[model samples]
Target: MEFYLFNLIRWILNIYYYILIARILMSWVPGMERTPIGGILYRLTEPYLSPFRRIIPPISFGGMGLDLSPIVAFLAYSFLEGGIFTVLRSLFHWVG
Candidate 1:
């Protein structure tokens, strides 16, 4: 049961990770967010990314700004995934 649960959670997290990456990549193309796929990606990822954005404002150089929220979000995800798996392994003795 623990093996199944762990795999399920890992799969879901991997999908969301890809979704976040897609959303970030979409930002590179102007008007991409207005497209159907881009809109879906934005809706899926923005809720997770917004708090980080609020906490860390974008860095500016000249007129352009580089958003670090995605990087922070990724780091947070990595920590969260590690912590969750650690607990699961210790509690259930499920080796991955």
Candidate 2:
């Protein structure tokens, strides 16, 4: 049914959102990227984030730079999730 399909896709996207959060948190720890979990997170999130990185270069503070790609990626993901759910709701005649 469309209801179940919509929930399933929503659940998957929610999991991906959590994965992105985990990846962001993992970056704070030194050498975290070398670990297996970190590697998995990197593989899952990098493709989604790389284009944002290309579009927006990091902010430079003398030698150390602050990467804003993840923040941009999060905002973009929120919009994308909203749009997908909107289309799905219309297709399913969802009331809420």
Candidate 3:
């Protein structure tokens, strides 16, 4: 049971991490958001991305501007997934 839970959580986090990547790619395409999948991706990813955006803001170098929030979000996801995996591994070992 515990192993199943650990795998499930890991799987979910992995999937969401990929979704974030996809959302980043979709943003560069013109008029993608009007389509169904694009809209779904937007809705799914925005909640996770919003806080990072608030903290980082968009940065400008000359005429070009870049959003740093997605990079921060990916870093956060890596941290979260590593912590959860470590805890789950230790707990499983302790219990079993």
**How displaced is residue 75 in candidate 3, in Å?**
0.6
lDDT of 3 by residue, 1-96 (tens): 887897789789989989999999998888998899999999999999999999997889787778988998898989988888888889788342
- Segments in model 3 whose C-alpha atoms lie over 4 Å from true places: 94-96
Report the lDDT tens digits of candidate 1 across residue range 1-96: 878899998999899999989999999999999999988998998899999999999999789999988998999999998998999899998787
Candidate 2 CA-lDDT value: 0.94
> What does candidate 1 score in Cα RMSD to the true structure?
1.0
Each model's TM-score?
Answer: 0.93, 0.92, 0.87
- Candidate 1 clashing pairs, residues 3+ apart or interchain: none
Candidate 1 global lDDT: 0.92
Better of 2 and 3 by lDDT: 2
Q: What does each candidate score in C-alpha RMSD? A: 1.0, 1.2, 2.2
Model 2: per-residue lDDT, tens digit, 1-96?
888888899999999999999999998899999999999999999999999999999898789788999998999999999999999999889956
Q: Considering summed lDDT, which 10 consecutive residues are worst modelled in model 3?
A: 87-96
lDDT of each: 0.92, 0.94, 0.88
Q: Highest TM-score, which number?
A: 1
